[model samples]
Target: MKFRHLRNEKGISLLEAMVAFIIFSFGLIGLAPMFSLSIESNVIARDNSFASNLIKETIEEYQGVGSLPSLPFEETEDILWTKPTLSGESTSSESASRTNIFSRTISLEDNSTDASIPNGVVQINVNISWLNLYNKQKNLSSTSYLIES
Candidate 1:
């Protein structure tokens, strides 16, 4: 009988390693956008929540004073805690209104279908705008109603 010696190959082939790397890269590429979208959604939600709190606090303050504070109020002004601070020069709106208001009011004027609703209804709008990490301007607005009973 002739003695035969067999040599075993151990370790991945170059072609196999390359194929694995390519597959992994494809998966990462597919997953990257999903991760990005999730992060953006979280950021928007957080901003909206912060804005909502601001609006709610302002509303509560107005209720206590029984009048809405003007657009700008000094820190030493009465009911200063309820005042809304306009941030960023670019977001300032030029819309003007002449209500001849006997009392200070920051409530929204509802012009949509006023068919017998509750009295003394004030609209609360939470507006939040931010410059995202991607250098894009993002804004969100949420509306709610509050009536002093």
Candidate 2:
């Protein structure tokens, strides 16, 4: 009968450790651009959502009136929201005057289309414009027809 004993075994070598580190660093570098793109997409999406909500609210308000305003009327206004004071208390009337990042314009035109369609129809145009995080201009427009019932 013969017996053999095994010596000490070494762990990972320095070269293997360096290779793993290089792979990890490259992976992170590749993901860096993806993270930036994701952030930009998120900002654009949020801005678009806010604009859509504003347009919907304006339309609803006009619909509730059940009657169109004077023909060829246009109204432009800056969006404003409450700003909290340093004391963490409610906002005052003056504080409410602070403008937000968005601006909306509502334009109403009276007229119809081709021969089939009748006249006296009102066309409502809602334009929303804002500056994005990258200092680029962005705009969204919504159009709707207010037909008499």
Candidate 2 similarity to native, TM-score = 0.70
Residue-wise C-alpha lDDT for candidate 2, range 82-148, written one tens digit per residue: 3345665546655634334788999877653333335856777899998776678889999887775
Taking the tens digit of each residue's C-alpha lDDT, what string does model 1 give over 20-44? Answer: 9999999999999999899879865
Best by lDDT: 2
Candidate 1 clash pair list: 68-104
* Poorest 10 consecutive residues by lDDT, candidate 2: 111-120
TM-score against truth, every candidate = 0.43, 0.70
Candidate 1, superposed: residue stretches over 4 Å from native: 1-6, 9-11, 66-105, 108-149
How many Å off is the CA of 87 in candidate 1? 22
Q: What Cα-based lDDT does every candidate model obtain?
A: 0.51, 0.77
Model 2, stretches more than 4 Å misplaced? 1-15, 81-100, 112-117
The best candidate by TM-score is 2
